[model samples]
Target chain A: MENQAQRSPKRRISKDHWTAIAFLIPSFILILVFVYGFIGWTGYVSLSNYNSLVPDFSFAGLKNYIYLFNDFRFQADLRNTVFFTILFIGLVIVLGMGLAILIDQKLKGESIFRNILLFPMALSFIVTGVVWQWLLNPSTGFNQFLSVFGIQPKWYTDTTILAGFEWGSIEFGLPVAIIAVVIAAVWQMTGFSLAMYLAGLRGIPEELREAARMDGASEFQVYLKVVLPMLMPITMSVVIIMAHISLKIFDLIYAMTGSGANFVTDVPGVYMFETTFRGNYYANGAAIAIIMLLLVAIFIVPYLWSSRKGDK
Target chain B: MAAFPIGKLIKYIILIFFAIIFIMPIYVILVTSLKPLDEVSLATMWTLPSAIDFSSYVEAFSKLAPNFMNSIYLVVPATLLSALLGAMNGYVLSKWKFKGANTIFTIILFGMFIPYQSILIPLIQFLRTIDLYNTIPGLVLVHVVYGLPITTLMFRNFYASIPDSMIESAKIDGASFLGIFRHIIIPLSITGFVVVAIWQFTNIWNEFLFAVTITTSDQQPVMVALQNLSGSQIVQWNVQMAGALLAALPTLLVYIFAGKYFVRGLLAGSVKG
Candidate 1:
């Protein structure tokens, strides 16, 4: 590297380039050391059983992974994570697509709508999780409030007292966590999807809409038949990002339940945190992380690639 | 025209409905925050406060004082310095077109999706080894690494869009790289650069996971502290709500002030590239 720098003396150097390099080097080194270096070290640690409060290391290869496989909590957490991602991705797309369609209507006060829609997104995770947790806490939140209105609805603890759906059981666990977090997330995310979708809507040629109208299509028919298909690219954009978010969802669970080891609601990220930091099993935490990485890759890489191809 | 009016009205209705539902949670939070502590306890949380009270704001400010300052102590300098340096990287890579530039960009893009948790295990140890663990700089470095990719990518896209002829013209006239950048590029790219800066500022300000894990104190970021307050259930709800508001206020203010930058800047990468 030094030799290349020395050899490049005749290459008409500029302070801008030097400054740029200088500015970037710190961040580059930070990422390289903290991210890549740590990942490589995690790979190493996964091979050993590193316990907490002990400045010791051992070399036990693949046994940690094997134990990780046999661990029921790990398996259950895997299922819970998959469940969260599926439900979250599904709802965000449906509701987000709906919001995008509705908001895309060059209506009144669009910016106000946009800002209100986007504002919740600015709340930190602690705020997001705590707010949602308080609302859905059943005894002290929305349900209790509703009870005073002569409508005692049991929303969060299952039994879908929402007047339409009957889930048949009152389970206050992962299902509630998923539903609660998704509502909070959707409250925060629909704006993002709406923004992207509005951009997509704006991108569509006005001629297409007029042409649909000229074809004797009603406005509803035009929106349904002509506009929906055009929104796929933007819809995919929202899905890919939200899918990644849904996968490593730790903050919501941690803020809600404080990482309880007893009940369910435990996603892989939380499990990894507890397994490593709280439980003193660093190797096992690495194993959980490896699994999380694999799961995210399986979901996101394809979406980004296909979208890139979709444009082509 | 008659049929069009009906359809348009329906669209407005649906949009308003969805918007209301979307903002309902935040509205709930606002009302929750304004209620008196006793009123918040005895009364239902969904309704408006019987009377406005400011004591909870005082309590929350005090409870959140340590972490609130901790967040400022970390996010401000971290965002500014990172953006400054990140722009340099973006500018140099875009303008200089040095060797391995493509590889560097590719690596940065790859870094975007790599799960941060995977790096935490070794990071804790590495931080300990280097004595950077549990410190503001360590946490800021973590944020810088995360912040650099998107910000640099943004600045690069924006800088790349600036015509090469202007830069070359400056170069031919004996304008050094810095001179060209200072005179031509930076000024031209200021809007986009500020856009990226705002994005990085909001992001670093809102971050919780890294701050919580990397820094081991109640003096973590505001988000981490808000989360710790989550456990003290007997803790005053008004104060809790107030803390939540205080923690989120700066980012909200930033978003409001930099409205265009946040919207346009957030979408800049996708929009420009």
Candidate 2:
């Protein structure tokens, strides 16, 4: 009887553990089918000759990828994505870290300034796109203000490449029109980095800074040397987060400026959407998506792996 | 030396300058939306409206109301289901601590960073096969499934702060799995629920790529409809501005009210899980 009593509790505990795992099973299966399984399916579609209205699962090898590389629009997309990612990530970090440090100074009306900067994060990228489209309209909006200083730049409508050089079917230098889209994107996303850096800043101990000050470090040096290094992890998180968003950016560019005149603002997201849905070039679209996924995975895989390892 | 803090003055000046530039869009949106269409030309872009008008808002609201309702229907259910599932998964992952839990979690977290375009082709095929394409429920399922990673990440981190000893004591008291979850985890993680819900609500509400591709007219969400507002041949800048505000209103309101929770969600979603 006593033996039965002890084993009963153990059996019951095991039963409860089974239930715990059972609850997780449904989500696990859904993610497998939806996330992982669908990715495999996409890979298959990318490899097939599925380029028409009807499904064509016949093998085409790397023809779609080769076509994209040689194509003018897709080449432009690759260039635009590279420049946009670099400029957007760079500006967001500088601007975000700057605002974070300024706010950490604990000035009067700190919350108000923080709220104003962060409110844009709440608004949709579509709204940001639409509103900025007007605000930066070549002939109107900010141009009206800037005209007082005798300058009016055609923002998104400008088709000029800033430092032009031919590398492939298109210019491989910065596209001036992309700057307009970048401005709106930076405005919307800087708040995320700011919040992250601010959180990181707050988590840091005051004693560390006090110790630096006692050692005769200037405020700027203290932040540059002591604080900035400490915020490196947060910076990594921000870069990865922003890099992924920048890589797949569509709505903002779509609504703000559709592929510019020379496909200057086009990225893979826009290309994939247009070619697949509008043009019905399914295989090509799948290829673009796979490329985008690969680009994002380059940053994400390492980050996720390291973080997971760190957790253990 | 200057008696005044010149450093403080420079700081305020710099902050205010950026603040003005940052809020310029809002100012333009407000000013333009209140003006008559004739008064909304490029020449008068920076000027405040000669008179406040609600006509654009009336037009925008009429066009957007149905779609706004679609967003609400999509967001509420998706947020709830995802948050609930996240809480359940989080409970098991954090307190249960079975083998391979971290690996499973890392696999799931990868989903959060993936470009949705990668999965678009097959996802559409699967949805169409199930006859859920072009429906709000389909969008709901998409949001919930995709939302799982972040929501799970958030809830797991939230629950991690909760000590394991509590669960041990409850186990000692002979509470079963469901009983412990029902009586213990739920009540303790109410704030976690709020954070996760707010995050999911904002994301699903503001999401464009899915809303645009998945559903068509009449079933479209407000963001898609607002995007369509500018597609009309004769672009009414006033109406466009008003529609932008209307579409953004729900999330802006959430940020305004529950901003603390919203920021907490932001931190939780991004920082190491």
Candidate 3:
């Protein structure tokens, strides 16, 4: 009976279907023109090397791709993206779920906790970036404050060798940028994830919790085996959404690092822009855009299908 | 019904810890903004202001010349249009099943994840081609298209949750498409519209990437102007933090009013990613 309730009522499905279709045209046009249309146009442009202002692009036939392989920053961008993805997706989900679980319990000032957690979600990353830059800058930020306590938090420090590898590689390294991006994004989004987990937690029947408590299951045990598994759908949704955001991150990196970022902090979206419009490599930018879009699709469509299938 | 005092204590501790982490940087920014330049030390960026000062807030508003007003101008109209159109689109897509309906919805949902930067160049090019790129009209068009998927999705899901028999009854009474939406559906769904408004308002108000890229002038939006003026002076920390706070205040004020739905709606409706 509960499961039956979530479904759209079957009566007048046909009429509702028609209305849905009618109302859908504008969005359909947006997707058709902007989503696919951009890709199609970009594909055409990539083939012709139109660098700036629609320069007469002669067909280059995969030259851009070949050039990209050799392009140092391109390779660095891909690697940085993967690293950023792994960290952002990982932390946002773990910390998000962690924070979510911690807050799920009915507590005093729970709403206050929720508000503080969610406040960052309402901030523009451009603003957040400025805040973080100030927070991280060695000369002006809390890093400088650390000096008063006899601990220096240097924004740009030389690497120290460790075991077989070098530590704190400043040039061509993104330790500071990575920390800044992850901290800011997680602070902003983990609350979102927490909210999601809370939703799932709310959906868990009181009887279930009662049953677990009745069985002498410890609080941690009940959560580990019961709440955790039950929260899978929420977890999946959180991961997928975080992954999508990680892939498309631009404002924070763009604002913090600016144009002179030691070739570090370049993600696909940034590279895509750098290639597409900034570099005037429209097709390559489009190609980059396509890849980023596909990455997004890979995360979203499957999850949708999986959830839908789960429903069925 | 449960009285686990220890668990309650633990929960409070954890919540307090995260609350501190969440509010710390914002607190630091506030303190920094409120302190005068002379009171600032080379160190102790985390310390409280020596004296309570309001000049930063004043300068941020007055120095920038309607600094706060410009953001409201752009955000209010944009939010209304985006949410309105989004609701309309969601209604059509969810209620009407025609050819390519699912496809259309899916693609539009896909737009949810498209980074504003990936298309920034081409979009700028496209916008410039029409001379609407830098104008508010141009930004409005972009925001509408971008805002559609989420807002529409919200309306769609909410509309879907409503019993279909009620809709059929409205239709059987000779209600037309607009008639049902205006009289029957929209009347029942103020919450969904409010959720969309909150989401849209926050998003557009806090938006930076497109605001930075599309609008070329300091006269555009608070976000653009704030960033443009950030380091214009060697270290105008007071002004910058104040500007940042001013940039944050409107949305924060909005959030304070309806922060509950900010969490709730995010969990229920899909974020565009």
Candidate 4:
């Protein structure tokens, strides 16, 4: 292809070039105002005294942030978010990658299995929450099946903090009830990692695996030593994507189980919604939103930067 | 190769087990929705309904029908507008690249990963200021704006695969910017359009945070109404399950029929980003 610079004189513009800018201007402006501008406004609100229903944008200087750090519910939300993000991302990787490898084996009825795993990805998180709420109900749902084995556990309703120890007016351990939410989340989202890994696996040439086999690597070792290493980038992408989702998760937990007893399942997303909308604590909500954005940015900014650099 | 058979058996066992776990909720939804209230209980949770009951469907449809229409109204135009804007921006970014294009693209892409909470306070306030609050148009605008990042990313990646040689040759032939887009780029990007449209449709249809907060009561979408159904005082498992199915039906149908494009959209959205 001819170089683009070769066709046009240095620093001279064309009508088409101006038209292209015009085409992009609207979306550029919208994103600039809505995303960047809104974030700035929310940040300002977080620092202001805007806790009441009526707008109060007076400067409060980190009062909301300080209060959240010391608040019981917010403390629990932080703990829950940490546990949820770790468990959710871990399970999604293991299950999704495992399922992807199995499906990549050229087995009979492969598409059928793949479809079953992926169909849930199409449904709304709200629907998943509603359906799973019933399916995991402690007294009436999966417990009945578990009862056949003489074991039943209270699912989401359980507020028990496993390995409980006091920290900041809340337990500094995994809330057992969170396991139920994690199960539903993993089920809905594992399909994403599966699809991603499947695409990555397909991109890897068969000759590479053949070469590994020739090196006396067994089938398991071929995957462990040869394949899994090659799929690292895909894993990185999945982790970042799932991390963002797990961090901002609201609809699923809201629909399936509201902040459970003792706020075990309360995430920043849920807390933000209830505080801001339900309770009219706008500044507090904005603080939560800012924190959520920061947590997500920790994963996303570096990922976006490196990916753009990679594109070059 | 003597161990191959056992390995294969174990793979099948594991795959089948997870598959069952994945499909279990659907089975529960179906069985519970079809059962009479008397039979929808802990003891019979896993059992098939004694008689197929359509009353839950009637009730759920009647309750969710209006909000269901609200979602349809919101999704259709939001999907179209976002896809069109994305295509234009993508064409500019990929084919008509100027300096700092990558930086601008990166900035725009950041919007996609943001927790919507960060913008919710201001978004609602802005909507109210503009008199679009609690209206379907308000939701549509929100979806379109937020939807731009992913749609733009998808279309940019899609258009990137189209060789620059084609655009360069077309420009040499005196084809104007819109001319090339109209004559060549648009025609070649039907599949790109499909993937992005289906993605936007599904996302806007299934979105909840914006739906629940922006619109309340009658103006709310199906998902919020469905949540309300379950959250209401007297819990009706049958109706709740039926409502879940009803709310999920459109995207479910889209997945069943055009799932290939949907999956393509999924991979395009995540992998390319």
Among these predictions, the greatest DockQ belongs to: 4
| TM-score winner between candidates 1 and 4 | 4
**DockQ values of all predictions:** 0.53, 0.85, 0.52, 0.88
True contacts kept of 3: 0.56
| Backbone N/Cα/C clashes per model | 1, 0, 15, 0
**Ten contiguous residues minimizing lDDT sum, candidate 4 chain B:** B1-10
lDDT of 2 at A291: 95
- What's the lDDT for all of these models? 0.72, 0.92, 0.71, 0.93
lDDT per residue for candidate 1 within B1-273, as digits (tens), equals: 445587778777877787777677678778878887777763477788889888888888888888888888888888887677667777877777766666666566546667778888877777788898888888887777777777777887788789876776676699876777778877897787688878877878887778877887654878888887767866777677788888889988988887777877667644426
Give stretches of model 3 more than 4 Å off. A1-23, A144-150, A155-177, A259-261, A274-284, A307-312, B1-8, B63-67, B98-100, B231-235, B271-273
| lDDT tens digits, residue span A135-199, model 1 | 77757666765776876433344422122232222222244444665676666666666667777
Clashing pairs in 1: A20-B88
Clashes of 4: 0
TM-score of candidate 4 to 2 decimals = 0.98
As a whole number from 0 to 100, the lDDT of residue A237 in candidate 2 is 92
**CAPRI band for model 2:** high
Compose the digit string of candidate 4's lDDT tens values, residues B184-272: 99999999999999999999999999999999898999999999999997868888989999999999999999989999999999886
Model 2 misplaced stretches (Cα beyond 4 Å): A1-13
Candidate 3, residues A224-274: lDDT per residue as tens digits?
989889988677777888888888887777665552354555677677756
Pairwise DockQ winner, candidates 1 and 4: 4
Predict model 3's lDDT versus the native. 0.71
Model 1 stretches with alpha carbons more than 4 Å out: A1-27, A144-176, A258-262, A300-312, B1-4, B98-100, B269-272
For all predictions, the C-alpha RMSD in Å is 5.3, 3.1, 4.2, 1.6
lDDT of 2 by residue, B130-203 (tens): 99999999999999999999998999999999887788789889999999999999999999999999999999
> Candidate 2, fnat value?
0.81
